[model samples]
Target: MTVLLRSSTTLAALLLLLPKTFVLGSVKLVMQNGGASQCQTLWAKHTIAVGNVCVEADQRNPEQLIVSYETRDGWKLDDAHLWIGRNISEIPFMADEPADDSKRSVQQQQHQDQPYQKQQQVDLTQFPYKKEDLAGKHENFGFVVKLQHLGYSCPDTQAFVAAAHATVTARSSIRNGNTPTLQSAWASHIEPMKKHVLQGATMINRINQWQDFNFTLVCDIKNDPPEGAPKRHFANQVPK
Candidate 1:
C-alpha cells in the first residue's frame, strides 16, 4: 500500500510539471483591447494552409473588429513594416527579387523560443527572387497577427511576431457606430495609389490619430530544421 500510494503521488507531480501542448487545430486567444476584457479560442479557417479567423467586439463602438491570420495570401498591411521583431516591417510587392539577397546581420537579428525558429524575418519590401520561386511552397503554420487600420496597400509584410499572444487595448474612438467589419476595416486602411504613368517610390498614408498597443507576435517559420539552417531550408524540425 505504501509503495502504491508513493507511486501515485510521484505520477501526479510529474503530470503537473509537464508543459502544456496545443495542436495546430486548437488555439485560444484573449484580448483586453476591445473596450472590455475577453479571451477566446480561435477557430481554424477551412483551408490547407495555416490561417484562422474570429470576430470580436469593442465596447463604446457599434462594430466588431475582424481578426484573421495571413500565412500566405493577405500578408500585406498597407505600407507598414510587415511583422514584429523588426523595427520597420514594410514588405515588397512590386519590386523584382534578386537571388542571394539576405539582409540582417547575424548578430543583429533577435531570437525567440522554439516553434519560432530564429532568422525568420527576411526582407519583405525588397525581393531578390520572383514569386515563381515559391511554387507550391507553404508558410509556417501558426502566427496570430492583428493589423490596426491596415488597408490594401502595396508591399506588405508577410509575417511578424508580437511580444505575446493576441491582445489589443486602445483608448480613442471615432464612435460613428461603423461596426468595424473585415471589408470595411480593410478599406479604411487603404491609401491612394499613384497614377500608372508616374509610378515611383512608395509613399505612406499616415493615420490622423495615434493609437498605441502593447502586444507582440511569435511568428514561426515554415521550416525549422536542425544544424542551424535558415527557415527556408527545411520542414518543421526544431530542437527537442
Candidate 2:
C-alpha cells in the first residue's frame, strides 16, 4: 500500500525548491493583462509530471468560479482535490505529517537533495475517489463551483490549492498483466493497511509508484458596483 502525507511546511519548502523558470505543460506562468474578470494561470510542479492550472471568475455569472487542470504528453491525471482558504495549512490533506518520524526525515532529505528525480512516487491512501470515478472522464478533472459555495467566498483574496496524483506504469509491466490498478489495490488493502500502519508496519516489499502535482494560486475578486448607486461628479460639471 502506498501512503502519503505532507505537512504544510514541506509544501511551502517544495514550492521554494521549484525552479524560477519552471515550465508548465502547455501553459506558461505569466502575469495576466486582462481585468479581474480574466482567467489567472499558475504552474504545478512534480518530480516526473508537469501541470498547468487556471482559475477564473465565470463570465456568465461573476459569483461563480472555474478551475481547470491539464497535463502534458506521456502522463495522465488520475484525480485532483481542491481546497480554498486563506492559507495552505487550512487544507486538511496537506496538514498531516507522516506517522513515521524516521521515514519522514529520510523522505524530506531525499526530496530536498533531489527535487526533480525522474522516477515518480506518489501516495494516495488519503485520497477519497476511486480510479473509475476519474479515469477517462475528462470533465471530472476540472471544477465549477460557486464562489460562496460551502461558505468560501472571494471577499478580497483567497488561496486556491490543488493536489493531483497519478500512477506511472510501464508497457512491459502491463503487457505481462502484473500491474494492478491502484484504486483496486487501495480498495482491497486500505482497511487492513490502516490497521498495519497504526500498528507500526514497516514492510517495504513493493515499489511505490505515484506522482503528485501540487500548486496554489491567489485569486483577486473585483465586483462591479451595486445598481442604482449615486454617481460622483466634479463641481464644475454639476448640473447648471
Candidate 3:
C-alpha cells in the first residue's frame, strides 16, 4: 500500500540520520586577549550556554585557562581541550591526575624542558583550510592564523579553529592519494534567532587546488534567557 511504502521510506531516512546527530562531546574555549594578541592570556573555559561554567575558573584560577563545564547537577572540569593537541596523552583525564600533585609537578617540569615540542603543527598536504598559512607569531608565543572558510564540515575544522584560539596545530597530513592538497576553509557568520544567537560557520576548502568546496556549522547560544529559564551569569561561556 502507499501508506506502507511511505512509512518504510521514513524509517530508512531516520536510520541513516541517527548516527550523525549524536555528538561525541564538545568544548568551551575562551581566549582572553588582555590588550595584546601576542601576550594575551588564554582561558580554556568550559562550554556554557551563557556565562562561566566552572567555579574554579571564575575564582581560584581566574586568569588561567580553565576548560571546565557543567552537567545536570553542577559545574566540573572538562579535559576536552586536549583534543587540540596531536597526542591525547598530553591532556589526561581528571582521574589520571595523581593525589599529591606529584603528577602535575612532573608534567610542568617536562613542559618547561620542551620548547619546540608544541601542541600543534601544520600540514600543507592535508589541505586543512583554504590558504591557511602562518600569518605571524604572537608575543606570548602563539601563531597568528590566516585562513579562508571551507563551507563544509571535515576533519580539519577542529585543528584549524583550535590553532587560532588554543594551542598550536600539531597534526596535518595528506589523505586519499598523492595529489597537491585539498583546499578548504570554514566561514564564520552571524545569524540572529528569537531565543538564541546563531553563528553559522561555513567551511570553504580547496578540493584539489583546482576546485573548491564548502560546509557549515551553525553554533547557537541562548544569550538572553526568559523569565522561567535559569539565568546565566558568566561572561566567558563561548565555545572554543
Candidate 4:
C-alpha cells in the first residue's frame, strides 16, 4: 500500500483535470518524503490508529457519503503541510502561539547545513485549469457537509468556518457567473491550514493512513447580502 500510494502522482494534484474523469472519491494523505507511511503501518500494533479525525459517512452504504476528495492531493498543501483537520473551525494546534526561538534557529541551521536548497515545484496547471482538458465540466463549490477521519466524524456543520485543505476539483455544474480568478484566490488562502497537521496524520499513535478519506463541501449556500454588502459564496461564513 505504501509503495503504491507513493508512486502514483495524480493523487497529490487537487485540480488537475486528467484525460480520464475525476470522480469525487475517497480521501488520502499527502505522501511524505521519508519512511513515515511504512513505519506507521508496520508498527500499528504499538500505537493508536486514529487521532483527531472525525468525518461522517456510512461505510456499509457508500451512497450516504456526500463529501469526496478531488484527488489524493485534495487540498493545495506544501511539503510541510499535508492533510489537515476536518473543518476550518477546528484549529490544527497551537495556531496562535509564536514559534519559539529555538525552532527558528534549528530551521535556519538546517538551511545552512544543506548543500543545495530545493525549491517547491509549482504546478503550471494548478491555478488555471486548462479549459480544453476539462471536457466542458465547469467549476463550482461542492458543499462539504461533513468529514470523517480515522476514528471520528465531524458533522457539526453549524459551526464550520472556511474551507479547509481539500482542493477545488472540476464538477459538472453550471458556472453561472462565478469567476475562476476568485476561486483560485480562495484555494490559495486556505493552503496554510495543512501546516502542523501531520501530528494527526503521522506516527503509529496517530492515523497512519489518511488515504482516500472523503467529505462533502456544502454548495450553493446563499450569503444573502443586505444593503449591498460584499458578495459572498459560503453560507457558513456569513453573519447571522
Best by lDDT: 2
Q: How well is each residue in 55-94 modelled by candidate 1, as lDDT tens digits?
A: 2232223222223323334221111221233333333234
Candidates' C-alpha lDDT: 0.24, 0.35, 0.23, 0.26
Candidate 1, position 95, lDDT: 39
How many steric overlaps are in each model, in order?
Answer: 24, 2, 41, 28
Candidate 1, lDDT over the whole model: 0.24
* Regions of candidate 2 where Cα sits further than 4 Å from its true position: 1-45, 94-132, 136-140, 150-155, 158-240
How do all models score by TM-score?
Answer: 0.18, 0.41, 0.15, 0.19
Give per-residue CA lDDT, model 2, range 10-99, as digits (tens): 234334444443221111112234333222222222222333445544556544556565544323445554444444343344343434
Greater-lDDT candidate between 1 and 4:
4
Angstrom error at residue 67, model 4: 7.7
Model 1 TM-score on a 0 to 1 scale? 0.18
> Which regions of candidate 4 are displaced past 4 Å?
1-114, 120-137, 143-145, 150-186, 190-240
Root-mean-square deviation per candidate: 22.1, 14.7, 24.1, 22.4
What is the C-alpha local distance difference test score of candidate 4?
Answer: 0.26
Ranking by lDDT: 2, 4, 1, 3
**Candidate 1: 10-residue stretch with minimal lDDT:** 1-10
